[model samples]
Target: MSSISMRKTTLAAAGLAVAGTLVLTGCKDGNEEVPAAPAAPSSAASAPADGYATPPAGGASSAAPGASAGGYDGASGAPAAGGGAVATSGQSFKIGQAATIPFTSGSKSGQLALTVTSIEAGNPADLASLNVADKVKGQTPFYIHYTAKNTGTTDLSFASVGHIKGLLDGGAESGVLLIAGKFDKCPNESLPSGFTTGKTQASCAVALAPTGAKVTGAEYWGDPYNNLNKPAQKGLTWK
Candidate 1:
């Protein structure tokens, strides 16, 4: 299998973004860009598919301590609870729970109240609408839907805010498929105009598990948490 580098951008000075690219194997050639979909609110559109595969090579470490195996059964389609306490790194939260953590985008820095509202299972057939590789099409699909609220000062307009991944049973991370364009099933977008304090945004990431396994949880692998070289470093997880 050939190795390919997937650029994962982070904030940089002068409107430039920079971050180390992750080397992944077994990826098909050509970029997969879906046409932008109509804007919509973030919510679980459907139940996810099953199956398990090892995370991309050199991915983040295993789930942090206290991570568990389960699914969130919270009220469907409801916004996350409000005015909750901020959560620290390495802490675990459940579905529908909020975690206010440090956030950075472009040259701006602040805190965002992030909530993993649901992990909806998606049909592999959905891949037909995308230009993904065949292997990716055969794998199960999952939508990691979330909501983010800017809890700190600073307008994060046009700054990106998403570093979430699917967590399978036994602490293994799922293969995160990044589509360049909009995917209606799991649409993602950056902080809109004037995303200053008290502003909130909704987005989603696509997670693919090998046929027959399911995504049991989700994790926030922002900043130091995504340092693949530091295998000991852990990220916040939710089950």
Candidate 2:
């Protein structure tokens, strides 16, 4: 080869070497990070054939429209083992030995038609009747334990059914003192129905001569009067 050609070839080789060295230097300096590839989205079609998809982000919770808000995915079936919905039976109650105090027959006019399917006393001192009646039943303040779908239906008020007659002793029925109106007397504090964690309509009691001497026997009316008898306050009333 001619000297000039040789010299040109030498320069070309040096230039290539310089370019390679610069690239090597860049790598060694760590000036640039290797770019990460974009991730592919999850495939809905690839979901498990089983009715359930993997539980939501938080264990078994996934929000499905019109379904239980959380912890419950609208899927069908009984509640999951531990981390799902829990069903509750209706509130059932039994009446203790009940006493019916008679309302003056001529005084009030109506068919006292409240029905009592079952009655049992959860506790002796405090009586609880199931499905008693309203004024139409001629029974006031009788407690009927009930269970219902959580329809958000409840009332908060005070009621007064005038002149209830209860038989304190086995003797004849006489007028029992009425307080806020529904409850005959403040229930025994020890009773479950005595107080609730989330309510204000405390049970009523007559200003009896002796403490806890509430009306007991009248064979016609240990009625469970309700607070629904009064003019509703704040538009919230219970039945």
Candidate 3:
């Protein structure tokens, strides 16, 4: 072959060799191990759907109210013999009993024309559904119904003032009662039947709408607020 022709043949052969090598690499398959792709992250390992916040991802949280310092468990049990547990300051009532527990606050010690519309007996679980401002429905049927009228001159503020007394059997703070907690705003769980709204603690001096006077709304202060730690407000002479 001519020298020039020989050189061309050599270049052609080199080109073919490169092409063949590329083709083989492109057709890789079967057992020839290919580098595995990076695994995709999973979604399940992400945040949960429990309406609660993830701790590690941010910070921990507790469901219980932070201000839960001192309170009572109104559903502990029945009262002692003679109906005097000392929680009521010597006051006692019969089982399934109801009363018009009157109270007052403000200038003339705001008079609370209050009464237990109904009172039932049971455990804490019984007051499970009792809520304020729509937190829970009438689930806690274990409390006494206290219907109070604002027979005073000011608006009933449930928050500023706490619970006074509770229904008791034989004098113990054993009867159904509202739980206790220091509230700073409209009520949530421990509210009374007479509470018209949770916006502001109803005033104890609420004048009856019929009379166009401000009055205090009712309250079911939970636990200690019910009658444990706090002293009972000396309400107006009710009976």
* Per-prediction TM-score: 0.66, 0.19, 0.27
lDDT of 2 by residue, 96-182 (tens): 221111111223311111122222222223212212112112223323221111111222111111221223333323222221112
Worst 10 residues of 2 by lDDT: 50-59
Off by over 4 Å in 1: 1-86, 227-232
Q: Higher lDDT: candidate 2 or 3?
A: 3
Model 3, which residues run further than 4 Å from truth?
A: 1-109, 127-141, 157-161, 164-168, 175-239
Provide the clashing-pair count of each candidate structure: 6, 30, 48
RMSD in angstroms, all models?
A: 11.2, 34.4, 30.3
Winning model by lDDT: 1
For candidate 3, lDDT tens digit of each residue in 1-239? Answer: 99999999999999999899644533111001111123343221211111111011111112121212222343122242223121221222332232222233333233233343433333323222323313223322233334444433444443223333332222222111222222121111222334432222221110011112211222233222234244441111111
Q: Report lDDT per candidate.
A: 0.61, 0.23, 0.27
- Superior candidate under lDDT, 1 versus 3: 1
Sorting all predicted structures by TM-score, with the top scorer first, yields 1, 3, 2
| Global Cα lDDT for candidate 2 | 0.23
**TM-score of decoy 2:** 0.19
